[model samples]
Target: MTASLSQLSGRVWIYPGDPDPEAVMPCVAVVADDAGSTVVDAGQSPAHARLVQSALAEAGLPAARRLVYTHHHWDHTWGACAWEVEEIVGQESGATLLSAEARRSWSQEYLQEQVVANPRLGPSFKARARAMTGWADFAVRAPSRTFTDRLMLSGGIEVRHVGGKHAPDSTVVAVPGSGVLLLGDCFYPPPFHLREPGPAGEEIDLRQISALVAEGFDWYVDSHSPPWRPPVPE
Candidate 1:
């Protein structure tokens, strides 16, 4: 499968991820300004990162000068080293978690060992492990900068931590210049390993999510899904 870059609006572009048999990639975004572009979500591997760079080059956008992660998930942040950006930023907790993961072995055997040690991680771990090939070069890169609650960057871009059941360190990016809000995976339900298998104990904070939607963004893009326009509250 291949990924193509598409314009979401002025100053905002998206490289929609392709879900192949090997790996299910995350959607990568580009927010451009006069200085340079700030890439959101790095992708699955160096190879995946290269596809994004190629798409950017084909579109005439300069290589990303900065990378902002939505969270610390492997699908979204493993490609950080390949980005070669000047600065990489993520939420404090995510950065810490990623830093911890960077110390682990990504080999298949190690991955299987993890599952064996923690049966709850079987499904999730298996899915991620199957995506590995050139494990020797596979390295997890942590964020160079970390923020606790929110951070504002050039060109009207804002990154905010919005913890969700999917991941407590989840983040949402808002590009007001383009009216596109990158939701990352904040809306996803808790992973199977974490789920209680019953009614919601603590569902995603709709108040917070609706608050974001209430801002009237034209596009709400989440990783692994098509950009959508959620109905605005009156």
Candidate 2:
């Protein structure tokens, strides 16, 4: 399930999922330096987490020292506990949502309702819900660290916590040195799964993401897709 670090450019290692992309969600864990590694988002299950860990070890990078949740969705945040990291960072609002026990309970219940309403999700939805059962316990410890606007991590990696567009608390991790941007669920690739309905009449904030992409990035990393790709030139 763990792929080796083949194409090395600026010490970047990508771990692809074993199953087809449709069956398995993708995650990108980037190591800024020896001191810590910044995980873009947790995978769908513990097995994916293990694959990430194995890839990190194989690449000579440290295990996920800092876990970063792109959004507050279960698919992205459930497997976070597998890392057992000390510090989990995200946007202030997202961190707040995860911090409260009531909110966590409500979110899970809401997802369950959605599954029941749409039987297409069927057993898969229930399985995912079960996987997220322990979130109340894990999410409490998650996102111990929070940022408002932007924060600079070690190794010149800058993470900007952008809101008002995506999920009320979407954090985008940008590596200025490498020009790699980790965009969580904000502007996902094709075959996008709008798991939750958008607010009333507001559309996705493509402008914000476009502006960031315009700023200049060598690679673009999304939560639901494969490895980061080269960003279009401004």
Candidate no. 2 TM-score? 0.74
Question: What tens digits encode model 2's per-residue C-alpha lDDT throughout 139-207?
Answer: 333477888888887777677866544477777877666657777777542222434444533455677
What is the alpha-carbon lDDT of model 1 when measured against the actual structure?
0.83
lDDT of each: 0.83, 0.64
Per-prediction TM-score, please?
Answer: 0.91, 0.74
True-vs-predicted CA distance for residue 110, candidate 1, Å: 0.7
Best by lDDT: 1
Root-mean-square deviation of candidate 2: 4.7
